[model samples]
Target: MTPHPPTWIRVSECFLSLQGEGPAAGTPAHFVRLQGCDVGCHWCDSKYTWGKSGGREISIDDALDEVRSLGEAPMLVITGGEPLQHEGVYALLARSLGRWSRVEVETSGVEPPRMSHAHLFWNVSPKLPSVTPRWADTWAHARAWAQAPNATFKLVVGSERDRDDAVRLIAEHEVPAARVMLMPEGLTDDVVRAHAPIVVEACKRHGYRMSPRLHIWLWGPKRGV
Candidate 1:
């Protein structure tokens, strides 16, 4: 018998554009921005996603239809308030989109997906103190796929304290330094310029990789960008 893949997930926005963050930066891609998050980052740009009412809920099929409408982008980025917190959405998205595209999920690492297939790239952007321990709680599940090249762990830093905290978290998890990325707190260009150089220097000093916010540079904190 053929195995059944997960169902598609409901989402907020589905569009095509250049990936603006993580290792996939500059890559033209399709984005599936799922709504609703509880990670609680004071500086979160997508706070609107925390409320279910903020985005209209669509069926998994409709979401796929929207993606299909965009034609070919080769890559798909599934991001959310906290993607892992909503299992069915991304899993269905991953299974359905995997048929024709290279898929990636940008998560807070606060929850585990019920299903995570090999074809889907897992981008774990673990939140800091501004968020909750739930972010750290997802590490065990993510570590299960730690060996997969498609999986990358990222940390967003706002201050020197955040940098120190990220270092300790990476070490505690025994996650490979190479697999970890240090991203600046990029709410605005001024925010990026204010702290990006410091974070970049810190990345160099710590020998960790850095991830810049491509979306911010391309478009300020606007939606569907």
Candidate 2:
């Protein structure tokens, strides 16, 4: 007998948007934003997704159906309030693997990724000391993800100090410089513009890539992109 898929998953919002950050930037994609996150980053842009309760419940079928309806977008990004917080996410990713050319999971690196698949790409964003209190867990999770061939380390940089911290973390974890991305922490166009040069310089110095927040530049932190 075929096992049943999850009847419902706690979802904040799902939409079609361009890949806003990391190496896949500017690519058209489907986004599944899940609810609930315990990794409290003070500067989090998606704070609306921080709580589990406020989200609307979406059945697995409906969620998949929505992705299918997006017509032939090549990428699907399952982001969060820390997506790994939900068990249903694994099943969702498993179901999405073959359908999308790339299945990327954007995570906080506070929780270890429990599901593994050949096509899975992990965009592991490790919080710096300026934001999250749980450094040990975040570092450990980041290290694990770094070992995966398809995983990319996207460290959020708010200042020179944060850039230094990101450098140390990448070195400590032995993550490849090519797979490391330094993204400026900002919610608006001006903020991103102000920080972009600093982040760009840091990336050049450290041999890491720079990831800009494209959606924020295009839509100014608006919900639903």
Candidate 3:
């Protein structure tokens, strides 16, 4: 018999944190943040995780063991820089789906999903023009990700143009209103509070859901929750 090489991945950090945004907000979740991102959104809070150099490598089995020791969080979130960027994450999801009551993958939708549509809660946020000018590429992904049975869309609103574009795309792509969420973009509590009105007004006018950066309100802008 031959031995198989241990599957390893670049991990920025793993922690037990409250899901800060999306339909599962406030849920106690185990978070596995992978390193490296091609999306390159300028306003991304986790900039320390922007490239391959940011995180350390660990075997997949060790990561699972660490999460097992972190107490019983009901949910597991495989997020990133971009989780889908690492092929080993598919293995992570396969092992974790049985452990957590719920599992989510928070993604920017820059790359196509490779998870074989295994049951997952995908918090799919297609970056708006304010963050990056990748219109055609991202929307193409949005259209596909929106079709997942448990997917939800969250767009970050920095200005009216961003809000308007969100509405335009949702309509063009025909994503359900209740499944679409809008969050105000900011690094500070006050800034998030200030920008929230714009997001609220957009939600009111268009009937989209609203997501508060709950972690920011509770703990301010810091890494590792």
Candidate 4:
């Protein structure tokens, strides 16, 4: 019998680093940044990952093995320009089930999750009005994510309008307050710190959690941890 062909996906890069944002912040994780995205955020830190032009195609096995070679990773973080946009990601996660204690997916919630796993945790960031193709355009996907018990909401807020928009999304989607996290938006440590106070105050009043830019604090805008 003939062997099956290896599944491939465009990869921007892979690195073992501390999860920088969301509820899993500070946790040591092997990050798999798949390339390609259409939900454009003007302030996107990873504009380099906007398309397949910069990334190379790699098989799911090779991708996991590379991260494993990096050493012991406490968790696997499948992030992206938009991870769900890549079909091979579903296979990657399916294969990662027993390898990592848990798997975290950081998505813009623009594309729907095609499969669900018991140990998979989704950090769904619903885009606010500040970005094009923002939350209003893709909120249905977020609503779908909220329906899953393992999903968490991470709202990156930089202004009062963004904060208000986050609140409106939470209410409309019926997302649990305890499962919501507010992260400051910035590419530099100073900028992230400066915006943190607003997030802290917002979390305090709303009973939401605060997610720090731990990787930014540790590496200061550097890539690949």
Where is model 3 more than 4 Å wrong at Cα?
Answer: 1-6, 116-119
Among residues 3 or more apart in sequence or in different chains, the pairs in candidate 4 whose N, CA or C atoms overlap within 3 Å are none
> What is candidate 2's lDDT per residue for 16-126, written digit by digit as tens?
989999989999999989999988889888899988897888887688788668666888999988888787888788778898889999987877767677778999988
Segments of candidate 4 deviating more than 4 angstroms: 1-6
Clashes of each: 1, 0, 0, 0
TM-score of each: 0.86, 0.93, 0.93, 0.93
Residues 26-54 of candidate 3: C-alpha lDDT, one tens digit per residue? 99989888898877788888888888887
Task: Show pairs that collide, candidate 1.
Answer: 7-92
Model 1 C-alpha lDDT per residue in residues 180-223, reported as the tens digit of each score: 88888877888887888778887887788898898898788988
Is 2 or 4 the stronger prediction by lDDT?
Answer: 2
What's model 4's TM-score?
Answer: 0.93
Single out the weakest 10-residue window by summed lDDT for candidate 4. 133-142
Worst 10 residues of 1 by lDDT: 90-99
Candidate 1 TM-score over all chains jointly: 0.86
Cα displacement (Å) at residue 160, model 1? 0.7
